[model samples]
Target chain A: MSRQASFGAGLWGGALALLLTGCQAGLRPIAALNQPLSGLGDSQSPSLNSNWLALISSRPGSRAQVQLIDRLRHAPVPLPGLNRPDSLPISVAVDQRGERLALVRQRDDRSELVIHRRSLQASQVVPIEPAGVPQRVSLSADGRVLAVEVSRGGLWQVDLLELP
Target chain B: MACTAVTALGLSGCSLWPLRRQPAAPAGLAAESRQQPALSGDGRLLASLVDRGGRTTVLLQERRTGRVLPLRQLRNRQPHSSPSLSWNGRYLALLVQQGGRRQAVIEDRATGQQHPLFLPADQEPQQLSLAPDGQSIALELITGGSRRLQVFSLAAMLEPDRAPGLLESGGGPPLQP
Candidate 1:
């Protein structure tokens, strides 16, 4: 084959190879959860560790609830005493092992922080005092650190809390 | 030789350009009235604000299944507002107005608990963001029509029963005269 022709053919082949590789990377699926989760509340604000997925959900005629699902079982793990008929569960964060939970409970008059440990079976309430009102709450993966978003005097601020 | 040089350049250009490109659109997310969508750290889930009939709600969806994971409408019966999600999708923060006053609230999505963080008496919080390590939030404060930026640490205000050393929490002891 002529040298120029050979070079052209090689270039075409290389371009095709490159194109294929790029297509594969772009099309690769990122999720393996094939089965659609059914009968769960419409989830919002999801936080995940390796084994657990947590979110806020609501059912018809009921207040908002926080749902923690075990990824392996795809079932809800009930968080007793965390939900009240009148109050709403607005946010949730679970520790690495899904053992510790940091959450926000909203009542008509005020909202409060409830940190609970599954193993300890104890829930602690931290008064978000002095700060204005809590907007968002998050916990470090280790469950030792807490972050709260607060609104005061018509402005927004984030408050960091260290839990014992 | 010229032909060889051209081929080499062509090959180099090809290497620089990706062969396949993924769609820019997020997987399976339908076009809706949703605004301010935040993806999880892993990009497997998305949280956004949806406005319907003058009501605003925060929605979460699993990217792969196109299934809307059940989330309670965070703004239902509350004021219509936008919220920011933490990088890990663990925390959601937003503004709420009650009794003619505005405030910020944080929700731990995992446990469905909500807490109120108090702001200064007269200053107003304009917007806020969570720090990546989930330790603090950068907040924009507005007072008397002027704006200021500030960083607030989670460890500083959340005084637990036991105190971790200042070095450990990266916060120094309170400054006193």
Candidate 2:
């Protein structure tokens, strides 16, 4: 009887240890994409779906570029005239369908909300209020409602910009 | 009698362990200094930023059960700035500063999948919103002098095997003429 009690206690203790470890593991990413983006002063901002990844990177002393990489094809899509050497990308949002792309670009103190339709091969720039500089941006799935965070005189405000 | 006393003592000790008492969203979180309450579409869950005891944490709580989800990833930050739940309450998007860059991340509750969304440099995400269809997310970034809005599509990210529908079929207006 004493031996059985000892075995049972050991089993319970081991089960407790395993349970604690599992809880401590927390959430983890299934896969982290490896890209050849480097040599920048800041970290890269990348948004990925299961297949495509849109990453923003700036070369040494050059303007930032938003590059789209196809995960299955393992190739980068060539976007001619998309990279503006004179302006910097502030933020980028891709739609669920990977059909639309929205980003904020800044030239000096001025900023504009740029929407790119991948399928149509066209883009648009919406003018923003000149009172403050545009910072972060998000677009709705249908590409109808746009939200921009603007800072004026040291205060942050959210601006909802509707696309026509 | 001695064995019974020892067993009771051991159980009591385990129950009193500090690790066993999980950290939760304290009361009065909505009244904190800077609170952003994001309620789910069905109004079943609410995700909010709470400043408790000089520290800021993002909490997701079930309205009826009063049970909070244990989001350990958000706890690593000194202050988890902004948290927004999706319309379906399946995904959560928030901002955190990791590796010296402020980026947004989306977490799936059921699968515990945490993926970081991309943003530009020096532009910290100030606010986050998931679209009603859960196919896109909106972020408001605050840079040095300007602020901008960005929308990321979840359809491609979520459904990689499917082909994207053409825009000319009358989905949305073209940005350029």
- Candidate 1, residues B153-174, lDDT tens digits: the string is 4533222211122232436776
A1-164 in candidate 2: lDDT tens per residue? 99999999999999977764543232222222232322222334444443454656555566678876565664567765456777788677655456667777877668866777777776666544436666666554444445555565665444444333
* Interface RMSD, candidates in the order listed: 22.8, 18.8
Task: Note the chain A TM-score of all models in turn.
Answer: 0.74, 0.67
RMSD of each: 25.9, 20.2
DockQ of each: 0.01, 0.02
Q: What stretches of model 2 exceed 4 Å from their correct place?
A: A1-32, A35-43, A162-164, B1-78, B82-87, B93-177
B111 Cα displacement, candidate 1 (Å): 34
Which lDDT tens digits does candidate 2 get at residues B1-177? 533543343322111111111112344432233244444533355565555567777777764454777886666764676566554467777777677766677777756777666544676776666643345554556667444434455654431212234342335776675
Question: Highest TM-score, which number?
Answer: 2
User: Quick one: how many clashes does candidate 1 have?
Assistant: 55
Q: What is the TM-score of chain B alone in each candidate?
A: 0.64, 0.65
Error of 2 at A78 (Å): 2.2
Off by over 4 Å in 1: A1-36, B1-177
